[model samples]
Target: MTVVAHPTDPTPARAPAATRTAGRIRGLDAARALAIFGMVTVHFGPFPVRGDDLASAAYRTPYGRASVLFAFVAGVGVALLSGDGSAPRVRSAGRRLVLRAALLFPLGVALQKLPTGVAVILQYYAIYFLIAAAALRLADRWLLALAGSLTLAGPMAIVLAQRAEPSWFDAGGNVGIRAPVALLRALVISGYYPVLSWAPVVLFGIWIGRRDLHAPGVHRRLVACGAG
Candidate 1:
């Protein structure tokens, strides 16, 4: 990743430190940038591309994975923006997240009225933010444990719910303009990215955010587990 020299190079030559954030996690931002690029490809390019070419590879690769990365990274952002491991800071973070969600939910609903074919993820995104807000107070280990359990059990629960009563409640895609009853159903049970299935990724990312990324042990675990 070091294009100019080894990370531990002895050379004193370097760029200005103006861009460095004393406490920022650079890796999370890099991952987010890559996720955004992947999402762009998925949104603009045609699926299947009819060949074993770059387009087809892009189409197939980013379909589901990019959004997962995006959701996870957003959770990390929440943790970072909330500051560190403190109660007041966490509450402040929760307020910011809730307010942002409030603004985004209305924008998402308005966007739905447009003719764009995109299956907007904003409404589901707002819900994910809400979930992350509540989860930020949990200890790191508990967050990881919950995320792991959710990852294993969420799909099964979704399957059961769908079988038991499919779309029995559709709050018209969570658009407040669309009947109030349909809002809950569209956001939870019948949405394109159900929180039940996607929220774990966010939680897991939040768990990751709680780690000391500068530590060698944390980096090793992230590399090992992410590779796995």
Candidate 2:
């Protein structure tokens, strides 16, 4: 006797990658909003404290934190722009990032000319975009390795450089665009946020962004790691 064959149920169709990608990560948005708020509090808060508890707390809370969060978010953006690591996508990202750097460099320099009292981090941010563009083709493992290497090497180099040229590091307070060499030095090593030390943060962010962030497993891991 012949046995009757039964058909298996068809698998459900999942959303396209692009469709999933288009959805915003609310967590990132919230983090970004917090960073922005902190930055504003730090920048625009009343100077000299004047015994105001709220102002004192605001300054204490967001002083160093906001800028770092901003840089990490910027790195995440770089990873998103790289888009699946395809050659064409990478090339497109490179162009867009390069143009952003170009725009930001000049704008940042111009901002420095003002008597704003704050060391504008825009120029350093521009350099970071340039670095991210250059490393767009690197694999995630290599990116992680590079970031770790930079984190160690950068501070060591800074110490050595400071010893070698104490005058260079000592001459702080915003070098002007007219002095290209000095400006370059400040951006690389002497500025408020030197690219060398900060690059690791950006690179790590890119690595995080490169992951399957849409996955619940990833979300849980990230949340746990962040909380820890």
Candidate 3:
């Protein structure tokens, strides 16, 4: 899928970085930027955009949606990085994604130890990457089916898990690796962005990522879905 500089170019097999960037969808870039801004607003404050009267309203906009957007965008990234679902090199992609997770998990743990009150989401993000690695091997229909099932069952499962073991949830707040089992519980069920509940969003993003996004028909369908 390399975009050569010209039809007769000798290096048609490999596109330059600039050439690749030129071919990128600007809309996706805007979405990613907006999502990042929203995350920053949630983590810090929307001070730059606020007036005295509109402060509360501004803060409310990105509250819960930021993390969700991040999850979705992360899924899209996974798809694009692994060659856009056409004919993924699953083993290679899995290895790369797992290595990223391995690096991120420890870093996330360290960030959690900081005095800053923000709940570190990087650890959960690491888990999501691992999930994406596994998901890269699935067909589109299966991915959609899995996402739908998770959407229905994940939140319910979390609620039940919390009710059954309140102490585990409590331990989740204590950010340390001393209790590995409790850490696992928190990551999967009790943490701020638990994988059980959030994985579907990522899966849906992967589904979206698989599509021919450049198509006008696809854009129309996406718009219709949003409106519905």
Candidate 4:
């Protein structure tokens, strides 16, 4: 999008241009702000509070769910910003995603050294970014199918890996620690929103982006879906 100026009505004070721009998507920004707040609450640790009762619930609720929503919105934003069916623009966008992933992978590993347990989302996000970019050129139906299949198959794959003989896929056991290689390995595993399962959300976002958000009856259907 294009940002347009709105005339002030009967008020002496004027809102900044940036503020006006932000107001266009107040809903999205509000949702993002709530997600950030939830993240801070989850990461703040149970200092004044204790045990896994409320704390665990908080961690799994609003925070985890909001983070996933934010990721999906991010994918939608990417698709919207990249334009429709423009190969060169998509490739350029993909290059930027690759660069971001390269930077984030190391940062994610560094963050994992902190006291917040071994689980880190950035590494998985980096991997997702790269994979999603590769799949961007495909037809929407194909993209949707691949994403849906991978997401559905991921749990089965994990279960099979767990049941099978010891191998690299056995993520349960202890492993060696070379910071560089470890980061790469963790990027491949040790995360809840694994690339296989998470790509579908991004693909769904792409599908939404290709549609007319302002079309009559569209928002109603979306609201119904959200309700369901």
Best by lDDT: 2
How close to the true structure is residue 32 of candidate 4, measured as C-alpha lDDT?
Answer: 70
Ten residues in a row with the worst lDDT in model 2? 8-17
> Which portions of model 2 show Cα errors greater than 4 Å?
1-20, 46-52
* Model 1 weakest 10-residue run by lDDT: 12-21
Clash pairs (backbone) in predicted model 2: none
The reply for model 3, stretches above 4 Å from the true place, is 1-22, 47-52, 84-88
lDDT of each: 0.72, 0.79, 0.75, 0.60
> Using Cα atoms with residue i matched to residue i, what is each candidate's TM-score against the true structure?
0.82, 0.86, 0.83, 0.71
Candidate order, TM-score descending? 2, 3, 1, 4
Give residue 175's lDDT in candidate 1 (0 to 100). Answer: 52
Q: Which candidate number maximizes TM-score?
A: 2
| Model 4 lDDT per residue over 58-117, tens place | 665765676677677767666655554467867887888889889876676567667655
Regions of candidate 4 where Cα sits further than 4 Å from its true position:
1-24, 45-60, 165-185
Give the higher-lDDT candidate: 1 or 3.
Answer: 3
lDDT score, candidate 2, position 90: 83
For each candidate in turn, give its C-alpha RMSD to the true structure in angstroms.
Answer: 8.7, 8.9, 7.8, 9.6
Give candidate 2's TM-score. 0.86
* lDDT, candidate 2, 172-194, per-residue tens: 53888888998899889987789
For model 4, the local distance difference test gives 0.60
